[model samples]
Target: MVDPLLLQLAAAGAAIVGFGWLALAMDVHWEQAQGQRPQPAPVVRLLRVLGSLALAASLGLCLTADHASMAVLVWFMLLAAAVLTVAMTLSWRPQWLRCLWP
Candidate 1:
């Protein structure tokens, strides 16, 4: 039988990686639209890289979590991450996000 917890962790990991790519793409598009001279902002780039690393670590931790309940919580967090991605894609309207997130 397939382990449900493993499946949940795999889904969470995929979601995190997917969002990381999406964020990178959005950053590129935003920069291109600005039409400013492309200058690498060290601090901002460092933060984004660190954030991606953190998400990868979270994925690892989620996969190793032993408790089924913890897996469920991780799944919920993954869902929240997906929702946040959608909200960001939709221009980050406060009211719509507040209804679901707050």
Candidate 2:
């Protein structure tokens, strides 16, 4: 079995990446990002695909990391971390998000 901590970190990474995909899918967010304009349709589509994949991977990480109950806790905790990271990044350094999307 995988280390729970490692799985937690992976989950966090996935959430962040998923957030990037979410950001890429939005026009308004792009407009506000540092030097980033709206992406083309193909790019948006790609982002959607990647975002979904990342989120799914996060779930997989959690489930495989531990038993069901522990996995649920770790997964949700990592998700919260990911959300906080995204929110903080968007608030303080949206340019960073543009870097990911662009």
Measured by lDDT, the strongest candidate is 2
Give the TM-score comparing model 2 with the true structure, all chains together.
0.84
**lDDT (tens digit, per residue) of candidate 1 on 1-102:** 556566666666556544543343344533433334353566346546654664565555565654657765775688587647654654543233222111
Estimate candidate 1's alpha-carbon lDDT, on a 0 to 1 scale. Answer: 0.52
Q: Best TM-score goes to which candidate?
A: 2
| Local distance difference test, candidate 2 | 0.78
Worst 10 residues of 2 by lDDT: 29-38
**What lDDT would each prediction earn against the true structure?**
0.52, 0.78
Instruction: At residue 75, give the lDDT of candidate 1.
Output: 58
TM-score of each: 0.35, 0.84
Error of 1 at 75 (Å): 7.0
Cα RMSD, each candidate: 9.1, 1.8
